[model samples]
Target: MIRAADIQDGRLRGDEPRRIDPRVHEANRRSRLETGDVVVVLVGRVGEAALVEAEFHHWNASRTVAVIRTREPDEAAWLNLWLGSPAVRAWCERQATASTLQRTLSVTALRKLPVPIPPAGLRAHLLRAMRLLEEKAATNARITECAMQLSDAHFAREASDGTPWPERPLASLVHITAGTAPRPRPDHDGAMSEPGTAFVAPADILQSTSPHLYATERRLPRGKEGRVCAPGSLLVASREDGVRAVMNHVPAAIGRNVLALEPESVSDAHWLLHELRSRSAEMAATAQGSAGRELSRKAFAATAVSWPPQEVREQFARLAGRLRERARIAENESERLRELRGRLLDGFLSGTFPKGPLPDDQGVQPEGGLALSGPQGIS
Candidate 1:
């Protein structure tokens, strides 16, 4: 068993692959892992795994299982697919034993888990599908990176102007509206009845993303009389926690901890949203109170905001709008791809159908080249 200190936190590193500790020499280490070994989280929230395509060092582990050296490198990829499969995830969940905080898988139980090894042709087909998915994901990443660069450029231009611009307190340009705590309703109909409306709390605001207004909790119809936000208004969470206390992509009615800023000019919507996102940290820092720091409407209104030249603001609005649109497109495509991958995993792991077959060609193609093949009946 490896120590938790030796295992790098995978969540922080994104997709970068690393290795287990190499310093510890053990003759009978039953499950020795190496470069390209797939590591799966088998014991806890099972099925989360990454391919160890590079070498590193570490030792701490509890719920994780290190895939030992397999007969083929491609088998590691196949294992990743299996581990990610919904069926296997559910199975892992059933096998888990819970402690006070989390459920975990035991090593003996993991070794006894069943796995399907498809025929060579079917295996090749599955790999081909995965390769295509990876290619599409890479393309999506490039587009996202480009959009981020564009945002950086826009901000860079704004930062270059040295002249001090006129400032206006936030209150001057917009109305500060606060959300009310409504009585709890047992059903959606009850919540949306007279004087109730859809409201967003601080947790509802996802910073740097498009507006997300869907709330799990609904307010009574009577409560919404003064809380309805216009379609393009800026909603910010005043409470400092999570993505709340930041600007969101969607316009939502304010909850108790959120403040809605209605810009004087509709044209300034994009600019204001971008500005709020950029200054979220500063705003949060200035919020009052020891615990549950809050940004009062008066305080928020008193906050000074630099007013750039009208033309500059408009230019920023245009650029920001385009960037947001691109991000939305990328986000939608990514969602679709993820759903499709999930469906593929479900089908592949259920043993209901044979794995898809690869094309006749076997050798690796040129880097960044595309390959096409006939589609199966499955959509």
Candidate 2:
């Protein structure tokens, strides 16, 4: 079943979705997904949506997901893109009813969402551009995944080779510093690029696919620079799901829920990242609670970890660093593509881009010749 947690970074994570029996699937026929259906999260991370591609067809969604079917198949992509806009996202946040634990978006709010349609030609142009950029980003993600897998393989081989790596307390090899709580600021919401240090939060770490992070959901004010961790520091967070870690590529202020692990040497940082990732489940056991899990500093610090000699670690670091750098480059390129996408969408919606013929690559004529109709509302 596709739960709210399955909707991640504007895409559906089908890796480990819960499955239901055939009887259950047939009973809840309305939840069955058809190709081109858009599933939006109605609980946590409200409004996050993903298009139901051919592979996911016939899959049943969980109660937390709202299935949105466009009148026309082609409209599905356009509607999905519209739902990702800042205005729509903010609207979802405002409309969501907050409970003691989390916020929920009712079907009434989802049905009332305003979807502004651009001119026919402009809409066609925007869809083509969005597809091209999204495709590239997807390709980059694959490249990064492969690179990370290769690095993992290398670590496995090195750790298992003849010599026995000593079991040492985590605190002995690295300094574990807790993050500072963020001060209230009503001005900023959503991802911000304002002048300040990138604030690393649990969401940022959880959503990332790459081992390195260059930006985050929020930023810290200037004078708060002292709270920022060095560029190579590994940021860690724990939840009921598991433990996740990402090395910061830039100096970043760590949120209260995050823990910053700084190794004395750069080479050690590389080894530490993979070590922690490999032990995610093991480390998660040390977390304090079942709900809203928090890693126990005392437990975590006291935990024993594999500690290889300096020479062996440095050797592995050199090889792993090369692979990671390739992934980093792809991630950087993807970031640029995303920025360009936002600009293109903004320009087309604002009528900044003339309703003229676009470059061949950017323009894919829509199947229907009809001009885009009035504002659309979801059901």
Q: Evaluated with TM-score, which candidate comes out highest?
A: 2
Q: What does candidate 2's lDDT look like per residue over 59-130, in tens digits?
A: 888777888877765577788887777667788877887664456888777777766654455567678878
**Each candidate: what lDDT?**
0.54, 0.76
Runs off by more than 4 Å, candidate 1: 1-124, 179-230, 237-256, 288-296, 350-379
**Worst 10-residue lDDT window, candidate 1:** 370-379
lDDT of 1 by residue, 1-379 (tens): 3322122212112222323444433432444445655565543344456555444322223224534345566766776666666666667666766564335665556566576665555656766887787678657756866776677567757846786888888788788787664433333211134344555555445322334233323344553345467666677764443213333344345656567777766547666665665676677754666544465777778888887777887878778677767866876786677677778755654543343334542322212211111111010
Error of 1 at 310 (Å): 3.2
Model 1 RMSD, rounded to 1 decimal = 11.1
Best model per lDDT: 2
Q: TM-score per candidate, in order? A: 0.56, 0.82
